[model samples]
Target chain A: MKISARNQLPGTVRATTMGAVMAEVTVDVDAGAIVAAITRGSAESLELKVGDKVTVLIKATEVMIAK
Target chain B: MKISARNQLPGTVRATTMGAVMAEVTVDVDAGAIVAAITRGSAESLELKVGDKVTVLIKATEVMIAK
Candidate 1:
């Protein structure tokens, strides 16, 4: 699908921790891991599991750079 | 600083490709490079350059997972 945001990181789902309202998903990239906190509904819809390959999409507006 | 959203990727700025209204910043993490397309104003304000250590923040609302 076409997305507006430019940053797309391909990684493997390392683990998933689900809560009542949110789910924390850890994706293992080449160098490190990226943790995504998404809503439980979204997580369920994605049906994410360990060893699954997913792309982490980040819009520029949501990104903050600190030097 | 404390951010409410969860996803944070640590990386070094490798290069910056700028346009009239937007600038694409490439960050080199351990695994690969993440390219962020941000407004020129925000890029200028951050004073981002090559070799800068920055954190790429992705709010849960802005992140999408695809299998």
Candidate 2:
């Protein structure tokens, strides 16, 4: 599917934690692992599993830069 | 609306740049500015404008921590 987010980091699913309504999914990228919290429904819809290839979409109006 | 993402950072819209299909929206947070690339439709639907309050939703299975 096409998304508006500009940053799409390809990574592998490292782990998943299920909650009553939300689930935490982790993606291992070259730089580091990105953590995402999504609803259980979305998780099931995505069929996210360990070793699954996924893209991390980040759309923030502001990205804090540190010097 | 209820979203699955765990990280929701509250900030103000600093700037917005429109593109053919996507738009770049900048948010100014306490720590820093987060840049988000979103679809024109979503942007307009959200009625995102300068000085608007927004919450950045981030959902990933893993979060990398650096030293």
Candidate 3:
């Protein structure tokens, strides 16, 4: 199977919530997920579209897998 | 547009981390993301595959949006 060595993965933005300093996106994946934190301004500056496809990149250190 | 009022979203489980009580899912989405905490045991029982598709249900109150 082809796998991306980089942490970057592409997904569509399903939803977004904005706070004073942190913004979160509800990314839609065909079969997987990753919870990530980003610059609060990104949520606004990027104008995260509901169906817009974007990339989700994360460092392993930031990711804490349960299983 | 179709939206889930229940706050349920689909994503692939990239990774899971087990803690004493809580498990965190690093869900993969195209553009957006949501961080969720679940039962630690669920991580093991669910057997979240790297490419497994799963649903993320979030209660808005639990979400703190940073903009």
Best by DockQ: 1
Candidate 2 chain B minimal-lDDT segment of 10 residues: B1-10
lDDT digits (tens) for residues B4-47 of candidate 2: 35566888999999898788899998889998877787787677
- Give the whole-model CA lDDT for all candidates, comma-separated: 0.80, 0.76, 0.55
Interface residue Cα RMSD of candidate 1 after superposition: 2.2
TM accuracy, model 2: 0.51
Give lDDT tens digits, candidate 1, residues A1-67: 5887667779899999999998888888776777877888988998999999999877665666655
Backbone clashes for every candidate come to 1, 26, 32
**Interface-residue RMSD per candidate?**
2.2, 6.7, 8.3
Instruction: Write model 3 residue lDDT over A1-67, tens digit each, in one string.
Output: 4333234446677776677887667765444443445557666677765777776544332333322
**True-contact fraction for model 3?**
0.00
User: What is the Å distance of residue A40 in model 2 from its true position?
Assistant: 1.1
Docking class of 3: incorrect
Model 2 residue A43 CA deviation (Å) reads 0.5
**Residue B2 Cα positional deviation in candidate 3, in Å, after optimal superposition:** 30
**Interface DockQ of each model:** 0.54, 0.12, 0.07
> TM-score of the second chain in each model?
0.87, 0.84, 0.65
